[model samples]
Target: MSSSFERYQKRRLISSYFSVVLSIALVLFLLGLLGLLVLNAKKVSDHFKEQVVLTIYLKDTAKEVEVKQMEKSLAMADYVKSIEYVSKEQAAESMKAENGEDFMEFLGFNPLLNSIDVHIKADYVTEEQLKLIADETTSKSFVDEVRYDNDLVTLMNNNVKKISFWILVISGLFTVIAVLLINSSIRLSVYSKRFTIKTMQMVGATKKFIRRPFVWKSVRLGIIGAVVALIGMAVVLYYIDKTFPELEFLKNQILIASLFLGVFAMGIVITWISTFIATQRFLNLKTDQLYY
Candidate 1:
């Protein structure tokens, strides 16, 4: 009968520890998912920013050789992501297709100018930088005008700023929630062993001696829980990669690795701190007060 009771208590203790680790894993996994999105926010923003094109129209007197050289030079520019030259004929045809209007029949001549569309890099998409680019391009002798939708650029940058602000707010709130959840779970796990802690102190065990084993146990559980969370995060990333290949999220391996290491260290640190505090509480309580 005594052996049976001992086995049951042993099983219960093991189950309690398992529950603590599982809770930590779930919380950390959620935190990690949020981190993944935060890390990829810049990439997503850049994709949209690079979509805005700056069109530079050439003077009608410009020679074909000069235009080709200009296109090559623009293509090699650090700020240019891509460049495409549209001849006067191609521009007219595109307009005709869009509105079903023949420029030659309506106006006797095609007034559309030959232009080069330049997609600038993400970092140069700001209003000030764009103005500089347009002014420089227009100052060229062979360039007639440089044009882009300034209003649209302004709208995009403003929207990106708002979105980033909201994301940061959400990430901060979620982090605090994650910490509270992990701390609560660790405290509960320690509460179950409160009597054991008091008994050790009653037996003249020093605080350090009493804490060493439990602290080590907390560290081990923290590591195991973090590993489980990382595995969950890996599965999620794999699914995201397969489902949304265009996002190219996995390309930034360094950031993802840093997130993984950060989560692991956070788990251990939080667990260790929570366990220490919880154990310290029981150690300080008088024996008679423990019943309350």
Candidate 2:
């Protein structure tokens, strides 16, 4: 009977340990996911921002040399990421390919004006920056007009801001939830050992002495759980990189290392603090109250 009772206690201990580690690991995984989202949000925003194209239409009288010079000058602009000059002939060819109709041949002359397509940098996609670009381009002698989709630019900027706000709110909420969950799990695991804590107290053991072993145990669990969570996060990131190769640009080695360190620190700190607080509560409880 004694041997059976010992086996029962051993099984209970193992179960508690497993429960605590699993709970902590799950929480850490969620936190890591939130971190990755926050890290990549800006890169995604920039990609969309840079897609806004500004079309600069050149005058019919503008010579090729003048247009080329303007293109060279615009290439040096701080706001411009890239510029592609579309000659009237190239524009006519593109339109012909689009509809299988040779409008230039029917008209006897290409009516399409030469134009430069400017891809602005993400930092210069704002309304004011674009207005300045338009005004400057329009002032040039060879430029007939500057055109872009104002509605699309406005929509993209607004959507980016909204997405960033929601991401922040979600990340904050998950962090709080993770802390509460990990704390509760550690508390329940410690509750199972309440009798041991009380027995040690009755034997005149110091609180520090009683807590030392449990603290070390919690620390070990924290490290193990963190390692597991980090592995899970790495696997997820690997899958994401494979599916969306463009997202790889956002994944810097230093940034990922920092994220891993953050998870490790969170695991260790949350587990240790939760275990300490839970142990204190049980240590203060009287033998009669232990039942409750």
Candidate 3:
């Protein structure tokens, strides 16, 4: 009977440790997910901006050589992300497909002008920057007209700012919630050892001496939990990258390393603080309060 009771107690201890580690890992996983969203926000914004293109139409008398030279010059611009040349034939083909009409056949000749589709960098997607770019492109002798949807560009910029602000707010709230959850989890885990802490204090043990082992234990558990959380995050990231190869652009080695370190540090700091406070409470409590 004595041996069986001892084995049961040992099992309970193991279960307690397992419970604390898993709880911490779960909280950390949530925090890591939020961090990933915040970090990838810029990449998402850039992807949308790259979809906006500025069209520069060429004059009817513009030679192919002159168009190519203009395209080369536009490609060299600092704000240009990419540029594609669309010949008159390609534009007509696209329009015919869209409208289901052979307009060139009806008109005897292709009325569409050759144009360059220029995608500006996200940083230069603003209306003022686009106007400046259009002005510069229109000044070229071979260019007949430069066009973009000014209202659409302004609307997209405004929406991006609003979306970014909301995302930041949500991320901040989640971080605070995670900290509180971690704190409560650590406190409960330390609470289970309150009796032992009280007995040590009654035996003339200094507060610092009583705290050393509990603090170290918490630190070790925190490290284990953090490492497990990071492993889970890596697995999630791997599948995400595999499914959406474009997302690979958002993964920076340095940034990922820093994120993992941030999680690890947070785990250690929260566990230490929570354990210290809980242990201090037990140390100062009257023996009668231990029952509560």
Compare the candidates by lDDT and give the number of the best one: 1
Candidate 1 off by > 4 Å = 1-11, 58-62, 87-114, 139-145, 239-248
Model 1 residue pairs with clashes = none
- Residues 145-241 of candidate 1 have per-residue lDDT tens digits of 9999999999999999999999899999999998888888888878888889999998999999998888889889989999999999999999989
Model 3, C-alpha of 231: deviation from truth (Å): 1.1
The predictions' CA RMSDs to the true structure, in order, are: 3.6, 2.6, 2.4
Candidates 1 and 3 compared: the better one by TM-score is: 3
Higher-lDDT candidate of 2 and 3: 2
Over 115-223, each residue of candidate 3 has an lDDT whose tens digit, in order, gives: 9999999899999999999998898888999999999899998998998999899989988888788778778877888999888888999999999999999888988
Whole-model lDDT, model 3: 0.88
Off by over 4 Å in 3: 95-109, 247-251
lDDT of 2 by residue, 1-292 (tens): 9999999999999888988889889899989988988998888788889889999999998988988888888899899999998988999889999999998777898888989999999999998899999998899898899999888888999999999999999999999999999999888888888999999999999999999899889989988889999999989988888887865743598998998999999999998898899999988888999999
Q: What is the C-alpha lDDT of each candidate?
A: 0.91, 0.90, 0.88
Residue pairs in clash, model 3 = none
